[model samples]
Target: MKPSGGSAPGGLFSRLTGFPAGTGGDGVAALSKRQWTRLTAAHQVRAVVAHRWAVVVLALLGAAGAGAVTLAQTPVYSSTVQLVLTANYPAKDIDQVSRGSNYVLQRINTYATIANNSGVAKAVIDKLGLPYSGEQLMANVTVTTHAGSTAMEISVRDTSAQRASDIANAYGAEFPAFVGKLETPDYVDTAPIRVSVTTPATVPAAPVSPDPVANVALGLLAGLGCGLVLAAVRYARVRTVRDERHATEITGLSLLGAPAVDRAAPLLGADRAATPAAEAFRQIRTNARLRAAGQRLTSIAVVGSVPGDDAAAVAANLALTWARAGDTVVLIDGDFRDPSLPGLFGVPNGTGLADMLSAGTPANHALQQVQPELQLFLLAPGTPMPGSAERLLRTNELTKLMESFRRDGAFVVLLAPPLLANADTLVLLSATDAVAATTRVGFTHSDRLAAALQVLQAIRANVLGIVATRP
Candidate 1:
């Protein structure tokens, strides 16, 4: 392993495969067909539960509104006259024209006309003191003939049912005299449409114009239609990345072992309550050992493309893991601007690398032994350090530190600041043997990622690949 100047792909595996593949490609997410199915299924359920109820309520309201609108319209009343055709043969007959049902049928229409004649209607109007004309009366009335029968019925409608019925019966009573005037008079109407005094209209218990129940039903149907429409619209607009297969499509990355929600799995969530930074450390620890083929000891520096990576947390845990394997592992927090390892490990933040570089503090005093196996060296960013910290890796002291780790066969994992945000991490990479890049899932943008990856390629960094972190 050597210092990567501009990120490059080189590992024992890359060499053996003879096809050096970088960790990234042209940023594009191709949605899979199967994922589309899952997305629609979830979306359909959500749409039904959310919008269907609203559609129902809207339907009900629409029905009520329609009923009210109808109620506001003027009412129309109707009356019907049922005339029973009596066999009133006038006892004068003696011809073929007078005996057949056709003759009787032909004569019945005359009765329908006689039933609605101006002479009879006017007399009834005069008797009843009506306001409308006989012609108007006839206009409001319909005389319909029953099929294959010698009978016809007349119905009239107005704003008042009682008045309609009264007019009908009065005009009906006047029909007998008018029939006598007709040359072809045949029969008499014995019955007519009339209202019972006992059932006089009293503003009607229920309205005659609008039916609320039916209106409600119609509204509900309309609401149902609307709900379905909205549901379909939402169904078509769904997107998802709910599983590992989808994650692959979005990132164009290989399926490295995913951390199961269960932290207690073989190499998963060993610390359930741990921060995201700590989780990355565990993943990298597994990746370097199990993912790599050989048993050779490796020193991988953790770097991210942006700050607030909690990279120091990862270094601390990773170093602990190596030390647990009976190797003395030193975790170095190299971020001079915002040192975090000291606070993360509950160690003293005062008198660290910064103190040593500026105040001549001994390395032994600045070094904090967290465990018999693990040691943490918090980088102190004092006045002299911040100004020349980018060149800190160039010092003889840093070279001595690397040599000491090599001699003891102890692993040294340095936590570097993000290269994209600060120059400290990229500069420190020159001193590191390999780079373990941490990329935050769903946070890092593609353009910035392409730039960072390009740097690693330029630096020829021993690209140990990536650690995908979920916070």
Candidate 2:
């Protein structure tokens, strides 16, 4: 089978990212700084795309904010008046008009700046009776001349359209008098340079700001960018096992099977149901049995790191699978704190493992026939005894019971307590021939799985493999 992200489409990207040859895109291997950065970025993008609802929500929120800001702002209206700055003189021939035109062109730039002078602004303000000083009026006015053109444009912006038009027209009318005074200090009938208004200032039809569509678009882009960043951060900091790939990478154990996440379904294989969950249990059973034969295993113990995991369910279903295959099988509920074998098989919980241990009763006395047609049996934990359960599990009677089951040509499966929750599972380590860990993806933290594996290895338990539940 080809490794994940190892196909031609992703080969170049995987090499640049330094992903291992036989590992998947979601590998948890420790990587170099550059590789980590690239992989982390890629993972973040994938995470965001996989969860599209986040993007929609963020975009909507951003759009709403931008729209609100645009609406809350004050609307402004602008008016512009064009003036033709021509040389004014009585020309006898074309040569005189050409020379005068050149002279006026040289002074056009000076006139553009002069139009914004404090004196010119004050004159316009007084002429229009505006409610502002020369400096305040200057803030609302602008003057410009197009390149290689003798036309000058003066503009005024205000909240009121009428006021903007009045201010613009005042500047156009007053500028000519100001220029005349500068050119000829003495009173004269005509001036060398004259300014004339070609296009008079008119009230604007609409406001120039607060464009709804543009604001919303910008906001949506900003929100989506923020959502992408958040998704990346969440993926980078995740510590739980997300899938079977993550579990195998962290534990370095063969992945036997991944049972479906179903809270409503009954114990798989109990009724010989041909469901995905049941098939998963059968696969796990086959893998475990193969490993057991090579290691000369007689009794197998199924355990987890924490309570509420599907460890007991896996053990029970595995025993049923073997029994269905015409092999004698017995499931032992070793978890005294929370025994589920009696409830799962619908047998009386009275007089079971605890009873067998108190008295030197035969192991079969407590064993209940789960399926008469098939060679399947169950040993319930009976009652809750959290205090002495660990001590009771470590007794010599447990070893004797395992040997008795093996002699009867029946394979034993112990649904042991969570390894981290109690020491009962460790007690079964010496008696059981093989151990299998059950884990729930997303719910199981990588640290918890690692710690459980460390304890099993420290005790020299023959760990067959790991079975991921609800992958």
Candidate 3:
């Protein structure tokens, strides 16, 4: 993006829009809300779904890397000895009775302190004839209560298993002498409280780390988290509304519950499951209910910009859903060029919409009831039969047909041809209360869809909302 000098560089609308006068990020070409919705819905949303696999791969790599690193490291032996303290040292008068095993855990810290003290480290360093200082020598030592409980252990790590054992013994060997200075026994018994060694540490024959299995497990977990988070963020930021919240945000439409796909014919069920595309249409029905808001909306039309928008499928499923909901539903196949509803419901071709319009057959006579409360009507597409298609759509009889469907308590879903591909959609858009357009990922172009939306806006078509098709 070029810097804004406040003249749009070449007098574009950016200055008028108050965006910086540039031609890239702040350029006139920047996608509008409608275009952004189309672009992101057609691209980013599915990309997030694809990213799950990437996340899994990365997580596995991370785990593998961690494990390989752990395995490749040089082996070191750790020695630990559990100590049992019978009484509190340096403060025996405090109470030996209640202290019990806690005395062992509590006093062990003092013992560790004495063992790793400058004096002890110096002694060990000198005994081993080490070049390192006392502090440096003690840095390798550790003391702790196991599992946040009252059990104490003294730990030391070294490169050699034998040397590790020797260090453990050396620390204990000097511990009593050091503690003797800090506290005296009430009575010097025949046996002095001892710090006997336990589980002398040894260098293992096998490496203790670089676990491939663990790495893979952690990697998978990491990938799942990354994938889920990415999917959520993508879902949240999407401009395309699939639910009620999106209804108000995108087209100012209210949200009704998603209508169920009518499960009547074998083909309809198969079609519903064929691509699992009904959910988008179901949401459209839901938005239709919202757009109707207190007023009656008997004639609901589904439109799009191209073929393969599954406009017919949406019409069928929506009619079935409404029929199932105890409302009469008429599924109108109004795509006068590429009629596809005949095979869907086993209706004969060539004899439906074209014949009805040309013969001046009643609109109700053109309808075919597909289920108990659902009816299927064919508007067979091809060349219009003289004052047929457009005339039928824009007539008082057509209005009366719609009124009859409403009077019969039915919802009508007219499956119209895509706007860009058919003039009939624009012709019908005028008579209908609302329009719902479909956007398929990858197949639908953002800019073109935005232009179509602009056209719809100019005509003031109450665009119910958009239903994005899954890739």
TM-score, model 1 to reference: 0.46
Q: Write one digit per residue (lDDT tens) for candidate 3, span 173-252.
A: 66556665555556763222345444444434533344556666776687666665666566445433343333333333
Which candidate leads the pack in lDDT?
A: 2
Q: Considering TM-score, which of the candidate structures 1 and 3 is the better prediction for this target?
A: 3
Model 2 lDDT per residue over 1-471, tens place? 112211233242234334432342333234211232343444666668766688778888999999999899888889999999888988899999998899888889999988888998888877878889888889988999987788999999998989999989988889988998888746676778989999999999987776788889999999988877777666545655666766676677888888874655446644546887888888888888777775777778998877666786788788887788888888888877677778877888876787676676676677889888888888888763545554565567877878888998898888887776655566766688889998887777665566566567667788888988883
Candidate 2, run of 10 with poorest lDDT: 1-10
Question: Once superposed on the true structure, which residue ranges of model 3 sit more than 4 Å away at CA?
Answer: 1-56, 81-112, 130-133, 144-153, 177-220, 227-301, 305-308, 312-427, 432-471
What candidate 1 gets wrong by more than 4 Å, as runs, is 1-283, 294-297, 350-363, 372-383, 395-400, 441-451
lDDT string for model 1 (127-151, tens) is 8998988898778777666766665
Worst 10 residues of 1 by lDDT: 192-201
The C-alpha TM-scores of every prediction are 0.46, 0.69, 0.50
lDDT of each: 0.56, 0.76, 0.56
Q: Count the backbone clashes (under 3 Å) in each candidate.
A: 17, 0, 6
Q: By TM-score, who's the top model here?
A: 2
Candidate 2 regions with alpha-carbon error over 4 angstroms: 1-72, 83-114, 144-152, 176-199, 216-255, 269-272, 286-299, 350-363, 382-392, 395-409, 441-454, 457-468
